[model samples]
Target chain A: MNIKHSLLNIFQDNPTCWQLILDQALYGYLISQKNSPENFYINPALQEHLKLLLTDFKSEEFSFEIKEPLEKSEAKSIKTEAYFFLNGKKIASKKAHFLSFSFQQEEFYIAVFSSEKITRANAYQKTYDVGLAEKLKISEKAFQNNFEYGATGMALVSLEGKWLKVNKRISLMLGYTKEELFKLTFQDITVPEDLEKDLSLLKRLLDGEIDHYQLEKRYYHKNGSIVYAILAVSIVKNNDGLNLYFISQLIDITEMKRAEKRIKKLFKKSKEQNERLENFAHIVSHNLRSHAGNFSMLLELYESQLDEEDEIITMLSSASSNLQETIEHLSEIVNMHNSIKNTMESIAVLPVAKKTIENLSSQIQQHNLKITLAVDASLKVKAVPAYLESIFLNFISNAIKYSSPSKASFLEVNAEVEDAFIRIDFKDNGLGIDLEKHGHKLFKMYKTFHEHEDARGIGLFLTKNQIQAMGGKIEVESAVDEGTTFSIYLKKTT
Target chain B: MSTLKLTCIIDDDPIYVFGIQKVMDVINFCESTLIFKNGRDALDNLSSIIENNENIPDVILLDLNMPIMDGWEFLDEFIKIPSPKKVYIYVISSSIDPKDVNRVKRYQDVKNYIIKPVGPEQLSTILKDFKEDNFS
Candidate 1:
């Protein structure tokens, strides 16, 4: 008959014998059958009872029925429930646990039994309960709202590089919705240049070589901007020793990257400005001083040459004039350098232009030049007051000085607001320059293009420097014998 | 009473050269004088003189700044020539910068650093030194 029928017969006919077999099984006694043998050693008193039962039931027909199929327990062992019977009568029920392991191609099953009536707790069962509680605590903590909503991004990725789950923070950090992100792989969002490194680290983890890895990598946001992050990844494995998914944590560092770029750019700009200042100082020390020293030596020589008094006097007078001119230029440059750190103020541009025109009224009247001003009286720019006046003065004086002798000269000044700058245009009908020939040196010190008595070649250079010191820029356009237009871009006062 | 046999003036400034020539006339500085507008001209002519086995000048008044081959470059090239007679070089420059003065000392052939408008007294002292050495 079936094992169940046989178990029922044993349980009914030999109830004491079934109890003795279960007692021995629970107390770590070996029960050998025709071809299979089982061993247990949980207790000693039950073993004596099982030994006596084994001798008495040796000739009796006995069988057992598994009431429940063997399945993996929470403690990582096979567990099942079974019933024993003799002469078609049920005698006992048992809960059996087996730890199946393999060594050298041989499979072994070590079983532990618990009787229905006896509530004996085994070490494996106790460990199983504690392990289950600890796992629940960890899962509960991980799924808490605080952890999911933290500032740092966290995600779970599959072994194939697809994102299985992502917290709200990671979704927001990448500028993608949760639903949209779930459809994409980690490789899709990673920057192409950083994907290779990430893949290699993942390979090591999948090969069971590393527990986790951390790296600084770039990710692409939904808007196609680069996002810098410190990425930490750890692999979670299943009981079969395979990767279930990856736990990834990313710390955003985009702001820090932008700040570093800004600092580097600022450092380079300041270095260039310092180099220019040093070159200017060298010119002042050598070029200007050499001319002055020559004058002093010539004057002393003239004292001994009494016969050629008039000729020597003329030479000395010319030398002194040149020296005086050089000194004035040097002083102007020094003044501009000193005022570089001057605080800016909102000054009306029209009034400054008017004042500069008034200062040059005599020259204008002498030349019979016509002047037109179209700037608004309320137009103001952020600049040093002294620099504003000086800039206007230089532009107006230059227009008058370079007036064309062929025709009566006219000056037109106007201002317009453009974006963040107030663009002031000074158009003069004068002897315009051939920009192709002199454009490069137009704002350089001591570079004279036109042969004019008043062209010291220092006005435009100083004006350019002054404008730059006030956070402004100057541009010029000219053609030979036509006219010149100077455009000054000044930062507008808010 | 002129102890100097020959003197050379290598300068680009005509006015300063004229002044020095007038002063030399008053002092009876040398029997003959040679002039070059720049250091390159002086170097080329002097090199040719050496090649031709001609008599070289006893003294050279060199100006530092010129159109081509400045005094420093001329000195650098001149020292390599194998000369039979010792030629003393005086660097006359309008630069009062101490760096220039120190640089002049680097050239062993350069005997003195004179500022512009070299007075008769300075020339007389240089002549006195030359006469004393010649006698000794």
Candidate 2:
């Protein structure tokens, strides 16, 4: 029989025989020279299968050491059971047939064998099972260690809220021993106000509406103190989809909750104290003004009765006026703080700026300062009309008062609408303040930078307060010798 | 030399009252003058004057921040009285609080609001305006 035909017939019988030969069995013919035992040829498919099976097997080279003796006696072909070894280790054993053929007067041995038992070796499979079992044991220990000793409060709770297992951190968080915790259900220590919410979240988790849930809740400790924690819970279901236990983690936040409450109380107290101070200031200013008014009235009556100009009378008049001005300023500040929310309206900025400029036109002319009003006609801001007027008057008058003596002085007022605010810039070519040295004290009351006689040091302070009370702000950029620009931001109206 | 008729000053401060009275005398502000210590005193006396059909003051200068019944309370009570004659009320206060000035605008009977330390010039202007208003 032709060997090629026989092999073809074998493959035809089983369509997947080649696949089985490559994966489950190694089938290849080997050529060997008896004199040179290392001269062996292995097919590429068998080399590929050996590469998978043997850890140290090299793919390009094959050295087959046959230990079983072959007898070349009866026929030109021989059939026998044989074993193949590499480096004294038997890799495969199979039934083999050898045919000796002479071509060109040179002797050669061609052996054909196939083995499927390499894959089904009991020792190899047993060793693999042992390695897998060892890996599983190590991973299970790691999980157990993390569950018992993790920093966060961890627990395994049954479907009925009974504690099946709990970590040390969980026991410490609830002020309960591990044994004590296992006896009590999670509901037993949960604060009554927080239980309903936690249970609802758990129900959603169990229904698979959510895979897990996080809640900020309160629990009662063994010492009867409240325990605040942020809890994260996940359900652990069986492979068959039945309800099992729950894996819950809690991080204690009791101190944070207490700190938040303390801060809230402190804020309330400070607000009340501030209100009281404002009220006291209002009363004092009112009473002082009344007395000062009486003094001025009495002085006026005395002056009218005198037939000649009296030095004392002039002194008293100036003193009383000064007192009146100071009292007025004080009352203005007190009233500004007290009447904050009321009297606010959308006021056209251009008209107010123009009116202020018109009111101080003579002062501008006296100072030889050129005033430019570039405020938009349609720009409006949400502010009290009186406060807006005062703010404009303060800025314009300040610019005029502090105008540079040497350079050509100009006060250019411009207004433009910005996002959520109307930014009015009062750019002036005046003697700018030394913002580096006096920036912190620029807006403080009674802190005048220049030696101008009219610098009462109250204008900028009142201006800042008014701006802030109207939910606005003022920013100033200045250099000592250059110029100052005051930018006012007010809430825009439409 | 006096302008027309009765004028009244209601203030708690004696110095203010005396100074205003002297000024009224110098300006010949009225033919007759009435002075009360506080808002309650003025309200009571004026109500009786209206009841008796006596000479009611042509103008009332009401001072706020008094001891008994402040000007606001007095205005509330006085405006409710059904009087035949019109009583012009002016709220004069030492308070620079705009709240008080804004509150006076609510009373239709209140003719004006004036800050305190009323000098001769302001007083003369007020009298001139009052005279013109009455004659016109």
Candidate 3:
């Protein structure tokens, strides 16, 4: 029985037995003081029983005896019993390990001291039985929060393509919630076109032939839209001797895909244009060359037969003039071909813009055009200086010539830094071409839209070719009546 | 039949063909000469000759540029023939393009690249390489 239980059992007796118990308790106390040694040594078993009875008496009012060093007598007394203290008093000095015995078998009273230290209750900690639960609770809360939310489309897959775990980013990228994502396998979501290659790469990874695999592949979104992604799958072994998992860092590259598609179309167009140019080169080399050779032959015949030439001197003169004109045309074409500017010289934008303005000073003042330049002054671009001047002069002259005579012409040239590219926008308030109808042939040679007699269509063609050769591109946005805006994207070399 | 019965001339330019003929006459070269404007016309005649098992052109003077099919294109198509026949192709042009000259030399069947304005000396050299007499 515990101490409280033994004490309670002693005090909870009936009134008829209360006085007897109290008297016995008093006798035990007095007898203990009188002959402490004799009391213990008289009956060896009875001394222990008497000590238990005295120890059972509840009250902290007893005077404790200072027993001297057990010099033979005290030591002999202890042979029959043990010594115990209660409430700073030697209440029981006996050998009894048992304190109280009840009439009912299950009601024995004994002292029970709880050895568990008291601390505040942690999460769901009802009893002191479980240790370090409070510390574990604090650490677990921190650990649970450590599994951060955004992780750039993370997917934890088994080596066999089973979806083990996935983060919120992957779920969002795949257009599925976490609950829905766990139910699907990677093979199910992978594009059929990329499945075989990805699986082969994954097999190589599992065999340790490769550390990881990164590829731009497509995944089926939950909404049936194709999501282009840069997928990097890394193999990770579990700390527990479980299966290896693949951590896929999928970056949604749908924008990159769109850009790629645009670039592919642009490349196809340029390739077709190059093929056309090759055909044109062949035509010029054949037909024009034959004409030139024929014109020279006619001269040779005239020189050989001067008497026949006197009769056809006017015809010969006209032929010679026509030949000269043809030669001039050929020379023009050759000059245009040779003037394909492709120098990668990095020059400050400020100086070039200032020179272009100065070169077009008369036209700018003549047309009374309001010009604004918001280019980054310290910005340097890699391009041929002559080509830049030609492009600027052509654009500025066109703006001056084609602008509305009613209102003052406005021109704006500005540059903004984009990732890996410098985008320069040249805006002009001028007679814009109908792009919806004629945009395809805007950069084609001999294609003209304006009624201006001097608008030779070669300027835009040469400009486009020059820009393309310098690793830049030009895109024009215009309406027939509104205005024209050229968005030129040039790669930043340095 | 022992001598060259028919020497063929294949060129789009009539003036160049006339000039070659005059040079050939000056050098007292082959009398029977055939003319073709482009590779397509020449290949057509050659293919017919091949089908009939007749005498094909001993020497083909090809130009790089033409209306239908150019010289290089015709050469690529012509080499696919299964028949075991000996033929020499010569590229004649005024094009000073070094790339074209180097490319023509890479063809195993091409004998030489001759620049235009053919003269008696050029014809004599070809006749000498053929190991034939000056006049046939």
Candidate 2 chain A lowest-lDDT run of ten: A114-123
Compose the digit string of candidate 2's lDDT tens values, residues A1-494.
88786997888787798655545533555667655666666544445444444545752343565545555432565766555566666665656567655545655666666433333344356435665576678778998999889889999999899999999999899999999998999999999999999999999988989989999999999999999999999998888987788999999999999999999999999999998987777675777787898889878888888999999898998899989988887888788866878789988999998889889989888889998888889898999998999999998998888888998899899999889999999999888999989999999988999998988899999999999989999999998767899999999996
Q: Pick the candidate with the highest TM-score.
A: 2
* Model 3: per-residue Cα lDDT over A1-494, one tens digit each: 58666766666765545545434331122223232322211122222232333424333333333233223212122212334445565544432222223343322222111112111222114332233564567676774454336556777788778777777778878998878877888889989998999999998888778888999888999999999999898888667644378888888988888999999999999999988986776555445655555454445444544654464666676776566455444444544444435335776766777788898888889889888999987676678787677777777777777777777789898988788778878798778889989999998876889888887777787777767766789999988667899877766645
Locate the minimum summed-lDDT window of 10 residues in model 1 chain A.
Answer: A29-38
By DockQ, who's the top model here? 2
* B57-116 per-residue lDDT for model 1 (tens digits): 989999988887888899899999999888888998765545677899988889899876
TM-score quality measure for candidate 3: 0.38
For each candidate, give its TM-score against the true structure: 0.47, 0.64, 0.38
**TM-score winner between candidates 1 and 2:** 2
Give the per-residue Cα lDDT of candidate 1 at A143.
Answer: 70
**What are the Cα lDDT values of the candidates?**
0.77, 0.82, 0.66
CAPRI verdict (incorrect, acceptable, medium, high) for model 1: incorrect
Q: Which of 1 and 3 is the better model by DockQ? A: 1
Q: Please give, as one word, the docking class of candidate 2.
A: acceptable
- TM-score, ranked from best to worst: 2, 1, 3
